[model samples]
Target: MHILVVDDESVIREGLARILEGDSFTVDAAKNGHAAIELLQQKQFDLIITDLKMPGMSGFEVLNAVKILQPDTPVIMITGFATVETAVEAMKNGTVDYIVKPFTPEQILEKVHLALEQKKSTVEDIVVKKEIDCHHGFDEFVGESREMQKVYRRIIQVAATDSTVLITGESGTGKEVAARAIHKHSSRRDQPFVAVDCTALAENLLESELFGHVKGSFTGAMQTKMGLLMVADGGTLFLDEVSNISLSTQAKLLRVLQERQVTPIGGTQPVSFNIHLVAATNRSLKAMVAEGKFREDLFFRLNIIPLELPPLRERKGDIPLLIRHFMNKFVEEVGKDVRGISPDAMHFLENYSYPGNVRELVNTIERAVVLCEGDVIQKENLELGEAAEVCSTGFDGFVPTNAEALKEMKRHIRDRSVENVEKAFVIQALKRNNWNISRAAEETGMLRPNFQTMLKRLGISVKDYFGR
Candidate 1:
């Protein structure tokens, strides 16, 4: 946690810093509200302690600035003459707590914890209200099934808290989308949402990309760089395929999460970070932990708020809704005349078990929409990549009551079957040209920055790619 102490009195300013530092918080002292505002612009702090009556800028001014500058940040007010009206005024001005000048050490610490806890609650209330306020799911994600309703309810319940979320599901199950929705509905919605694919990058560069490094930390070190932890300060960091992170990097990450401080490589000082973590993985982290591949401690730390996504096969009732959603999307996207799926094609789709889940189904719909001659997508237009077994009951698998699953399944064959195919494609392009990034970017018709961003998201470091 990072805290800013602002007071015209030197004793009060420095004393608070010392007190917070002892509590394991990174503290910065500002002589007045003006200096506090300046520091606020340069860095992110979890809490701000400002005296109500400052020489240059009053605490009221600082409170207003904080509300504008970092609205989510909590501010505590301090004054010598504490009165009920003054306290109400301070609270009205957005001070989480009001304290008198002669406050004891216990009072300060108690108020600090209480205020921070309230801040967490405030964030949850704001986010949860925003999500449930609509009383509906996002337009992009369509599911009216009971299972999906449960998922939606879970998102609503958990989106409000700063708890580290561990989203587990198979590939193509929209894990990242769920993460994004959680962020969108949270207090940090306006902040940057950085997504990193753990499987895309090599082991060595992952830390530097995440925790950052100082210049000359290693050979070919060019300039000092800010890590994603700093960049994501006061916001959420989504780690995709987190199971792929190496054990060594996992140890470093565990320290950061535990301490809330990140020391750049070759740098002596540890930078304070206030970031929410939301990690997703297709692989079983528990199994990996049992096998001694994943760190048990790190696994336990990340499993604070577990959210498991149900596969499409298990949510067969939602197939029709999903198909229609995609149908409308692709209809406008491809500018095709295709209106909807034929009865036979819909039956074929409903019967098939989508191994790859929603992603494969969408890919199939996109292809079918393009190939369809008329308004309706015919069964053959589906190209029914694979056939599903039929039960005598009909569309259902085997049970007559649940027999809706038994119809002849039309397999959804998508070209990008591999989850990391895009990452691999970029890697292949880089390798084909001997890792000449600029050349690869030009050949691939992507800007250099875009290519580099893709690499960063995939965690692909050119230096690491060449066995650096």
Candidate 2:
């Protein structure tokens, strides 16, 4: 584990570093609190030892900063002029322990060991509780529908073994949550669970991130760095939006999977890792492979065990359960006194189809909870968006007697479906091009004027997606 030592005195800082280093701990020492805070921002430390009295930015100030930055990390305060009042004040300010200066190395080591052990126990307890909750029919999921039950079963079946899992679903269908569930139930639950978003980084940066690079490997490579695969060694690595990975990276990933080893960008030495791989994507790898966008070999490797999540529309019976779950969650989080949803609000929520799936429902509920004034949430409190407003009009009791009327009804349904699909396509194109209309049009093989016309017809505002 990594530990940081902060002291204005060089002698105290060096002495603490020697003691911690001798105990097999990676240590970084800072002469003052300002330098210590800078290191904290750059790297993560499991424990921090700071002297109470400093020239500026005292240990108490450092503790406050850490509470805002890394709240979970334990801090130990050391002072030469230690008193009962000072010790009590340190404990009140969130320091795990207080140590008097001129202390023996044994005392410091014992305190460090105790603090780390306590932190480990607290983390493991939380993990164990979550695992237990999930074991009882997947607590993360709210539905009791057969579709979700099947998903739970598949997760349990594949989690026991170290098999590559590919989760396919639409956006906001809780793909990452499923990946976490798999990792939590697996034997490597105690190890690190690293998650990476493939779509967030450029191709070159992503390649460097996945495979470590030695010093002077590339233009910006100033020092050797360990890749995420090595960081997740003996644990799980979740790759979200894996389909966005470029073909060249796919080939390299396939080799890593086939050989169970990774070679750094400039280093010839190969480092081996044992990680349970879980990949998720909203897009279809099969179609991408057929279109020559994704490698078929890598697809097969990742698809050893496949799990598909059902969209909210497909399992509408679970909407009420989900609404209540989200309502209780947001009410507590927002510290609102909302006790229930009105009948009209619940009806609108249950009937409205969430194109964005569970994530949309979550946002809707949180908004209502914040806007709600009374004990119960009203229909006005729920903002279902423009799409929901358009789709809310359904022919509930309309019985068409003539063939013409029935044909008109069918035509209306078809038009609405087409409109939804067209809007989704246009939005996706704009997103891929970072809201650049000209580039989006060119990529989609459409004239700029035609793309703008379509955007206007679909009521899509470029400004809405620009900065956001």
Candidate 3:
């Protein structure tokens, strides 16, 4: 651990530094807040201990600067005279710990340890941050693969801006999830996030759905209804499958986006809406523009921040995370005790190209969970697609295609470990049995302790399985 110690008293600084160093911690000393800030800018420290009152710059100034510059780093406040008001103010300024004069070495070390642990836990939780539990979060969108990480980074960068975003991807590559992610991370997150599927309704209905219509605007328009755009004012309006909207509706949408006002059909005046527009489509808007099916100007308007989500095949490294997620989801959905997928089943999943991307994989896991009977989900339960031919063997020497070689390599890696697959199965089984270890073990043909061992091996505990 790296620590920064700031104190005007040379003895106090040296004492703390020596104690922390004895605990195998790298320590940096600063005579005051200015020196601390200089050191901070030069190097990253896990923890910072500073005197409350300092020369040049007060500790409060340092705390505020750290909050902006390095919010993740924990700060501990130390002072010779401790007051309730000062301590409260220190905490409010984001001090992780407070130390009084004449403190023991163990006391300082203990606070440092606790502060580091808290920071770590907080960071870890942010890694798995969720938007609203529809499973869209920074963590839920899985992929360490460069392509997916690039998408994530781009989303983070663009979410802070108010520019309209047009997301284009193949069907089921999580366009909606990406849209939700952008909305969740944006400044408009506090307001309603309304989604409208352009293809789900007719042209006339879509027009009214976007812009509120009068009571007698058309047939069956019995009541004056507020459209999605008006309802989502000051928030986000997600138009999914946006390319499916007719040219007439596209023109109307373009007008609203360009003018920042929605005029209801049969209404004389336009209703102004302060909204962020995020449109997504499985169809290529550029191609549609070239085909003259979609307006070119509208395409350019919505494409201010273009984000494309790669298909599952391109980010197959995320398959395991997605599989684990779906397994947890299915166990809750089906109320089953099935442990997880078998080795062969996992190989099939890893090698098979998911044309429907994450959506198809989710469905496959759900189905497998429902069909699985034993403690462990076997190959028979998977009901998965055909494994892409990994190795094409002719009579003698065969030249392997690139696609085949890649598939073979993935299959070999997946086949090397059934341990992960088994844990997923066990989690499913525990969920099915309502997290009863004995029942889960009985259902999976493993002993109680052995099942616990598996849980430990999988980095899961019974309390977690049972939601304790």
Candidate 4:
């Protein structure tokens, strides 16, 4: 840990530095707040301990400067003239802890440890400073893949401005989740987050929903209605599935983006708006534009910040980590005693192709957590795809011509279908007999030898059903 100790008194600053450095912490001492600010501008520190009463810049001023320099860095305020109001003010200014001078070394070290614990690094190795202020949002996402890292960096870049963001990804890839992250990290997080699914409403009603209508504007317009744009004023407006929006509505949306004004249906005056627009889509807006389905002008406006979430299949290495996260979450949410999953089950889940991506994986884990009877989830507890449907885990060196691939595809489908049926039959039989192979074979009217043979062929073993 790197610590910066700032004090007008040379003895206190040097003594604190010696104590921290004695414990193997990297220490730097600043004579005053101005010198401390100069050091902060030069480099980063994990924690800052500043005297409340300094020669030039007070500790409160130092705290504010530190916030602008490194918002993640924790600050500890110390002084001999500590009062109740000063302590309260210290905490209100983002100081991790306040301490009166003439204290023991243990108290200083303890506060320093706690302050350093709160520093969450957004990037490793390289230190970065930016003017945009944002906090909290990326914790929900659980992955360290290169693509996800890039996504995090992109969100940080666009969150500072009011630029329109367009998130493109497949179903269940967490497009809305990404949008929420951007909003939470943006300056408009404290305000409302209004999400409008462009495909959720009829063409006529969509405009009314986006722009407020005066009393008796349409047949069903019983009273004045405040549109989502007005509701999201001084906040963020997320438009989901923008590719499915009607062209007429798209044109009105374009005007809203350009003019920052909305004219409700059957209304006279245009209502001005100040909102950050974030749009998401599962379909390719670019492709729709080429085909003359989506408006080209609106596409450019919404595409100012484009973020694409990768499918689970492409990032298979992250499956195990995601599974563990879901398992821990479901364990707490469902009040289950499950602590872990069997290696066989974990391996099976890791290898299975997730066609529905992260959303599908979450549902799969939720089901498994609900069905799990023991402390560890087994392979039998999981049913990844529909009816155990199988797909290629990867193209392992086998390449077929387009004309010749149909037969192979059919063969795979038929083989998987048959295997699914057989697996289901054996699983039902075992479940009925409490997973006893001999009795399960008897109940199924099959010889024990044949039953055990099928079990071995299907990679099913007694250890999977019961404790090994």
lDDT digits (tens) for residues 1-468 of candidate 3: 899999888998999989999999999999988888898899998999988887788888889988877889999988666464696678976997798877999998899999999999998887666333223325457655567778888888888888889998988888888888988989999999999998899989888888989989899999999999999999999999998889888887888888898888888898889988999998878878988999999999999999999977655556765777788888988898866666557645654556567888888788888888776666677664333232111111233457877687556446434544765688788879987989999998999999888765544545432431
Badly placed stretches (over 4 Å) of model 3 are 1-139, 384-468
Q: After superposition, how far is residue 304 of candidate 3 from its true place, in Å?
A: 1.5
Residue 108 of candidate 3: its Cα lDDT? 89
- Report the error of model 2 at residue 152, Å: 0.8
Better of 3 and 4 by lDDT: 4
* Candidate maximizing lDDT: 2
> TM-score for all predictions?
0.57, 0.57, 0.60, 0.61
Give the TM-score (vs. native) of candidate 3: 0.60
lDDT by residue for model 4 over 133-204, one digit each (tens)? 112115467676567777888888888989889999888888888888889989999999999988888888
Residue 425 in candidate 4, Cα distance off native in Å: 28
Candidate 3 versus truth, CA RMSD in Å, comes to 11.2
Model 2 has an lDDT value of: 0.85
Q: Count of backbone clashes for each model? A: 15, 0, 9, 0
**Model 4 worst lDDT window (10 residues):** 128-137
Query: Which has the better TM-score: candidate 1, or candidate 4?
Result: 4
| Model 3 global lDDT (CA atoms, 0 to 1) | 0.79
lDDT of candidate 4 at residue 439, scale 0 to 100? 99
